[model samples]
Target: MSTPVDTPAPATTGAAPAALDVLHRVFGYDAFRGQQAAIIDQVVQGGDALVLMPTGGGKSLCYQVPALVRSGIGVVVSPLIALMQDQVDALAANGVRAEFLNSTQGPDERRRVEQAVLAGQVDMLYLAPERLKLESTRALLDRATVSLFAIDEAHCVAQWGHDFRPDYLELSVLHERWPTIPRIALTATATPQTHREISARLGLDDAAHFVADFDRPNIQYRIEPKAAALQQLLKFIRTEHAGDAGIVYCLSRNSVERTAAALADQGIAALPYHAGLDAGIRARNQSRFLREDGIVMVATIAFGMGIDKPDVRFVAHLDLPKSVEGYYQETGRAGRDGLPSTAWLAYGLNDVVQQRRMIDQSDGDAAHRRQLSAHLDAMLALCETIECRRVRLLAYFGQEFAPGGRESTACGNCDTCIAPPEAWDGTVPAQKLLSTIVRLEREHRQRYGAGHLVDILVGKRSPRVAELGHDALSTFGIGADLGEQEWRAVVRQLLAQGFVAVAGDGYGTLVLSPTSADVLGGRTSVRMRREPIRASRPARATRRAAAQPDMPTEAVPLFEALRVWRSTQAKERSVPAYVVFSDATLRGIAATRPDSIEQLAEVSGVGAAKLETYGELVLEVVAAAA
Candidate 1:
């Protein structure tokens, strides 16, 4: 027997609301930020666009608003099934007729949504790319009139990207099939090369590219040397971000499990998420992290993409990421609501060796291997840079990082600017290393990795040195004054400065570059930042103060009451608490302490439907707290 699916009445049926009207009455915002209004206007006017907005920048509104304004259903192509469900659930909470089709749906449930879509009862239809790849699904889309096509996480179309999906390659058919419908592709992170690749692969070359400022000023970047990684991570969480929702990224499944268990043993609410976990456990853990306050999730990179939880207070990395793009996207998950957040990372020299080894050992042709190596080199340079981490990170994506002049203004948020590291003249050492590499290639006709070169420089008498007769080289004992660690730092700096290059194959051998001539001939002076000694005490995550909510002390009880009410509502509905009311909105309700529904309607996130649904209850909580 088939159960009848009740279709909720539309909020307003006759005329499409203006963009501002939709923003306020639907999504509960006073105005559009950044280029959101312009992007919405463009898409509503039936133009194609490629939107590169930072996470928590309201990328959803770009399509959601237009879907309400334009006739027919807006088709959003999402990649993950869980993400699709979450999105549709959130939309439904906001009184939007949103539905999703994915493998998680049984045949009857899927047919119900399909019937609704064809009947024009759904405003937005979310589908995984793999779903659209099915001929039956494509035929279904053809039968229904779609208002527009939105490709979220469009970077997945790039074959070289970290999160590539082969199904995304077939998305070009959207343009071919619905040639008249507007299309907008969006992603939180993309470098210049990736930007171009996404534009080309998605058949969005002709679309207007709206690249917002890649700078996430709310997130403070801090990187430290890995020493007692677990204890350091614990001290950081306990001291700085206690009782806040945060994520800890690990390099392996084992590390994730161990870290989670250790945090749990320490009385922290921690859970592990990795591909190795059973699907039910992974789903449950993810659900708890999204719904519960102050739960820490220890996970690999598989955990964060498309997660809509906006209150994540911090994202910490216990291991080095594969590339800058991966790091940027992962860290961007935090501070989505524009509150102060932390991006803390712990890395060591061994991370470099392991990352290089992985790249070299991977199955790929020379060109492919070279591409991967270039990506890693950029990331390594970021890790080792003494300049502002934000500046270097944004520069990787071709954005000039000049927030202010050095003498007058600057982004005082990053660790480097807050605690400046001293730079020392490395001209003499640079000359010696360059000379060593040249001699190794010219005299000995040999190229060696950093470890071998450092060994020879520091006068180590290894069997390989004796076999190669490398000790006979003049530059061998010249570098003996500097310890092996110091020499390693110098080589890494040289690689970063382009004075030296990593040779072919997995050995990571150093080779002289054309720029090395300038350093060797004393035509250019090299200045390298001295690596800070590993801290014996726990390092402070950031000098910045912890995030403080904007509310009066007297209203604190009211805020708690509202949270309790929201939790109850979310639990009753079997959805994440934020879907009932975000923390920011609850705070606003508390601070304002509205006495009536009309007054509560003025809150930033309170829309007509939400005001109608939860308005009276919110006021009741506020009044009761009195």
Candidate 2:
């Protein structure tokens, strides 16, 4: 489901001109953003395309325009019911004829939409990939004229993608059955390897592949040490993102409930969402998040795929995400309006230990285990790196991040660039940590996790240490120069650097890697990133400056008023406020304060349909504000 399903008007004879006309007539944008023009042209010309654009880089327009201008109705295969609902609603707001067939609808509603499909009354039709598995669905499509087939979130076809759906594997039948229908597959996040997998699985290897830059410069990335984590998260929301619509991601359902309750106790309008919750509760919470302002949803990874909320100001990670791809995909959900936003995470030594342990215990063959470990390793590299966060993030996706037209370098926006970390030599510290792990495995014939090892290194006479006879070890008290936290940092860095590994078939115990011998033999030195001494939260001015690319001070009143008015319209229409006009468009309206309908129509999001729908109302808001 998306914003631009067309009106099943007569097919235009020309591809480029028809697509360009649809862009201005249906959607509000004057011209295509990034590769939308080329992609749309390719699709309208009845050619297949594989588009890898960023989440908010006008990906919808590529298929939306062609689906409208082409000869017949477009069939879109989407994975999420909420996504389909939003897309159908947004397209309706744009005066486009879009209908979706999903389980969310009753039999009567489905019958009506199905009948419309048969009668050529629908412009674009949305369906879940699971729907295509039914012979009845295939027969319906066989009867209807399908101009194109757009596979949204096409990365799901990859067997190893973060969100893999078995039904996606069967999507290639779209080509097999309707061999001449132009197919377009779109995804927001995919590594080069995943991209290849998507192409091969979807049989789009022969299609035109469009890969836009994966960099999201508006998002400021920051990873903080997880200490007093609940308090830290509370302070972050209170100071950096107060009264903002954002998402908090936790790794477990229990964590989601606890975090959501904690935030609610603190008076934040936060709700919990996970598979364990009642289906109706989950749906209501998701709907509230989409429709209301400043509602924070604390959820597991299950909640976010294909969510189309545009004003999400921040996305916080209470625990380390499993991989770089997962991290990128989650963070991309924020700042979709091209406004400044934040991607914050609280990471610690236990994150590494827990992730490693999970990977070791995960059900898969050795190759799958290795694949999971590789993913965690990449995520750890991102969290532990002393270099610019954006550069490392982009490089992971096989792209070079060039901010402000500079070479691939520091973004001057992330936590690392804003307050660079010190890469101090820890060759001796590495030996001390590795020596402890070595002694535990060799001398005592036992292994332990970081807590026990750090206790030993810091010379703590804990009962476990005394019971295990670790106090008499030669390495005891030798590392007393550093505290327990410092020792844990050393262990974490070594683990991240691969000088040590977690023991196989053990309870998260530290074990030496093959490279540990190199460090112990004095052949390799270690460089550790010193966690900078910084304030737990940004200061008063930082809190005040939460809104990025701050608008003119004088326009504040008008903007807020317009927001209130937009909220009213959305509630009345029962659609997301963004489906009416994006924050960017509202900002444009506020800045221009256009009094006439013609002037208001010139704003970026005000297409011909919306111009006729809400132009007069917006003019009234502007006039009343004046």
Candidate 3:
């Protein structure tokens, strides 16, 4: 169990009877994982909690079991309105009374749910944080007998968090307005700073706080130096994750559309999803991605929050992520069912330049820009580091790790761990690059972006370089021993190391930082990674052989049959197939090959209501396969 670190634990509510009963009867889990029992017990006894568990660590159960065991409706504050319906339906499938109120509902629909709440028919009530600010909504809740309050994605209240929402700042009013209604704030991703901000902002200073292990041991983290990014992404998918559901994230709407189209052209079931698309199109795409298998949703980050798909095999980034928090949460979306998954990113020079330029041009004080710069710096270091990826990742969240149990690798499951990169002395390459920038500034009284600087270093007398007379400089051709790519790597690493600064117009011109003088004076040595060159097409066959598919040969037929049954049931009910039963659950059924409903109930994810609903149909499918 992950213990609560440096935070107060709520005194245990002695002798709780129905908590475990609700767990096994309602959700069909025999026992709680990690800190769920303690967190649930606290909430069930009218004590507050602040939970920071990773995605798919069963964060929902922390609030849910308590909601069912205690009296009155559990008021849940969910940030995403679009996902509320699916969430409510998933609970209903588990035989729990759940309802949601948001802008999408009609007046009659809202009234029906309100009447249900008034009559004490609702067990959990999902509301948007913005709804709490409404006077009429407050009065309605005031009249109803209220249980504990659940603030989902509670880290949004922290201004420095990756997904900041101003509306979450108002959530402290839940404790004030209903002072006795114990409020439990929950988020899957939170740094120490974000955690502190959440406690301060949500008035959870006295609440029991819990932090689960942030490391996802099942995910193999790999960062490639970007070269023909779309091609690299396609090859990765084809070789390792073909016919498997995944997400391909790009930074812009245009990139999302282009990547989706390109993948579709190659016979993949790809769909584009971003805020720039029409609302109806986005909804339809989201629905298909959820209902159908073997989909690759090419999207911006806008498409992933609140998504509960448990079988996502990989998450590929065509562009660099903004921060570690954003990257971790986005990657956490993959392999939610505890299967092996890959978190792959194609990172390069332009990503660094673009992020730095954005920070420079952003609207904020110097401190704010510094904050953004710090985040980008950390992200860049992660991409460039030669250490164990999981170790560095865990340390960022204040957890210590000792690397053990190798899996096709040296340390942990990551690119560097498998094929370790050499840390060569970058002093010469750094001096050559910094000399060009220094001479350009001293003699020409101007700095230049990487392209022009690289041309000068490589002795390439292009028209612009000739016109600018940079070819005559002493530093010109000083780096002729290395290729342009190698020179760019030196500059990229220097910028990442904070020895060189990105400054001037929005073009990402390079300048000397205060620390650059150390390299120029030979007072400090620069270290850089020598990444292995990527191979072309023929190597993919080898990768395909090494990569394991999602299912074994014997189970594939039964899994397909079960999927067909789930599809029919979902179509009849007009809900996503996963809402009926997640692919993880189906895979569990196929693997266990249960002959009776009692045996089916023994499988991990076959909850009480699910077993009661589909048990016979699943047994018939298994029998036919046999």
Candidate 3 local lDDT, 1-626, one digit each (tens): 12343443443433366988888888877778867888888889899989988988998888888888888889999988988988998899999999999988899999999999999999999999888889889999999988889999887898988989999988878988999998889988887888888888998877778877776877889998887998988888988888989999999999999999999999989999999999999988988888778899999999898899888989999888999989998999998878778899998888888888899899989999889988888889899988887777766777666535333223447888777788999998898888888889999999899999999989999999999999999988888999988877888888889888889587789899999999989999999998964444234335433443645557767988989988899988878788777777787788779999889998766788988898898898899989
lDDT of 1: 0.83
TM-score of every candidate relative to the true structure: 0.86, 0.95, 0.94
Off by over 4 Å in 1: 1-17, 402-409, 427-488, 491-526, 532-549
Task: List pairs with backbone clashes in candidate 1.
Answer: 448-509, 449-509
What lDDT would candidate 3 get against the real structure?
0.85
Task: Residues 448-494, candidate 1: write the lDDT tens digits.
Answer: 88777888888898999989999999988788889987887777677
Clashes of each: 2, 1, 0
For candidate 2, write residues 350-398 as lDDT tens digits: 8888888888888989999888888888999999999999999989888
Those runs of model 3 whose alpha carbons end farther than 4 Å from true positions after fitting are: 1-17, 402-411, 533-553
Off by over 4 Å in 2: 1-15, 535-550
Worst 10 residues of 2 by lDDT: 1-10
Best of the candidates, lDDT = 2
RMSD of 1: 7.1
